[model samples]
Target: MHTRNVVSGVLLGIGVATFVDETVFHQLLHWHHFYDRSTTAMGLVSDGILHAASMVATVAALFLYADLRRRRAFAPRLWWGGLLAGAGGFQLYDGTVQHKVFRLHQIRYDVHLAPYDWAWNVVAVLLLAAGIVLLVRGRR
Candidate 1:
């Protein structure tokens, strides 16, 4: 596999991990709370669904990038892979540091947070921007 394929795969993995936590662990298993107690019943609506969608989208993007790479659609650059990476990277960072590290609200809770929270947000934004640029530039 090429850089794009590798990065996309990595990102997809990370995204999947996040989805499992949000949808399965958080929603299904009731391991923890969501944004608030109001979101306790996410059967109708909640962030858990969004997390699953993001995972699917990122993985789909990676799948497309991989197919294009195999066909030499954009052999030189894997711009699309970057977006997949960005999405995955954000989830990974959010999971590892924000959730696992500080135990902040189980899932993403980086709004109106502290300096470190802002720092993480900035990093996630940069990664997403870079990934988007790569994906747009590499698209064939």
Candidate 2:
């Protein structure tokens, strides 16, 4: 597969993961918002912005994928590796950078953040490791 396809797939995966996280945790479960200090209206606005960004990223990825397909430059192993890496990287960033550093929001309110952080990072590490392995294999 072409490098472009791999990159595009990774971007698509990241976009999908972001949307899923927003939908499931932010909207469905009402766990947290982009900015915890803000009002409900602000939170809703943040969500809308996040959704728009995700859509843009996903659309770009789709366009890249389509272009690569037209060129017949596609690699399944690389695509899968990229997907895993992107999803894991986004998850890690959200859990650490956004949640911990930026203090955007915890996994949930009235709960200790340690356990959630630990679980989230652990899973992210696993995903990253799997992606690395796939990437190595794909290079062979």
What's the lDDT of the predicted structure labeled candidate 2? 0.84
Task: Give the distance in Å from residue 98's predicted Cα in candidate 1 to where it truly belongs.
Answer: 15
Compose the digit string of candidate 2's lDDT tens values, residues 1-140: 45786688788878987898899989999998777778989988988898888899899889988887788877778887888888888888988999889888788899877888899888887877787788788878
lDDT string for model 1 (45-105, tens) is 5565657666686667578666866787544345445545655475557655755576645
Please give the clash total of every predicted structure, in order: 5, 2
Which candidate number has the best TM-score?
Answer: 2
Candidate 1 stretches with Cα past 4 Å from truth are 1-39, 43-47, 88-112, 129-140
What lDDT would each prediction earn against the true structure? 0.57, 0.84
RMSD of 1: 7.8
What are the runs in model 2 whose C-alpha is more than 4 Å off?
A: none
